[model samples]
Target: MSEIERLDLLEKTLGRILVAIGAADAKVAQLFAISTGMLGFEATIIAEIHSFSCFTFLFLALSALPLLFSLFSLFMVLYPRLDGPESVIYFYKIARKDIDCYLKQVGGITNSELMDDYARQSHRNAEIASAKFAWLRKANMSLFFATIPWLIVVLIGYAAV
Candidate 1:
């Protein structure tokens, strides 16, 4: 097929992948929310039964919900850039020599320049995507570390009561 056709196919495939990633992310977020909510309810019940301060349970619940949500949001924001469109664009540029040659042979000057510009844009997009991915990773790691303390607090409270 022609270069244009190939690029079009790539774009379509990238779009589908992005949509699928989005759907998966949404499902994960929903499940995380539900689990966190259930855990909060259980903790609340335990605290009430033990006659401990309900504020402890409330604090745990309040913190857990937002932490889980933030993780989901981080994944959503980074997934597309890291694994979807930006990745595809990066690959496309790697194979761009063939595309440029093909366009030149076909006497497609305007199309050629457009593709060149797209490749450049893709490079910039990939860089930004990489930075975002790094940020998300750091955030995730921080959340993981934070969870340890939260879990310990809950466990201690439970053991005491």
Candidate 2:
């Protein structure tokens, strides 16, 4: 009805969207890890079934699928959105300002409690950002390291075959 109510609804909707994105990201990462691990097991099975030298290259190439996916996810996370860095900065600033305005309008009694609440909300936001950054960094590193050995395996397999 009011501008404040609309802003509050928008904030709530954004929060839900972010939560869904985060959940999807986690699920994707987990699936990738499981798939890669399964590929490693498959390679071991193939090595036991056939000569290690003969199939090594094929196995290596196969293992690269999950690694590539990890790199792709990392790129998605790191790529700047259409909104841009300035937009993100502005969004947070606006969010904090909105919260402050809401608190003042509500006529909170205690200064200490209001400050504490603000600090808690800020900390939560920081933690969310930190977690997202960490996930992206780890994914990138995993892909980078995995690629080298994967390439080596492909080369070795090709030479042997």
TM-score of each model, paired residue for residue: 0.42, 0.39
lDDT of 2 by residue, 1-161 (tens): 76556545555655665574466466556546654764575454445443465456554655566576675665565443322122222355346556667556457535444344444444454455555566666665666556656656645545544
**How far is 124's C-alpha from truth in model 1 (Å)?**
3.5
**Model 1: how far residue 34 lies from native, Å:** 9.4
Q: What is the lDDT of residue 130 in candidate 1?
A: 51
lDDT of 1: 0.53
Write model 1 residue lDDT over 1-161, tens digit each, in one string. 89888667656654554454444444545545544654564466456445545666565655465566556555655454423232213555345447666546446446655565455554555455455555455545545544654665466566766
The per-prediction tally of clashing pairs is 0, 0
Model 2 residue 122 distance off true place after TM-score fit, in angstroms: 18
TM-score of 2: 0.39
Alpha carbon lDDT of residue 151, candidate 2? 56
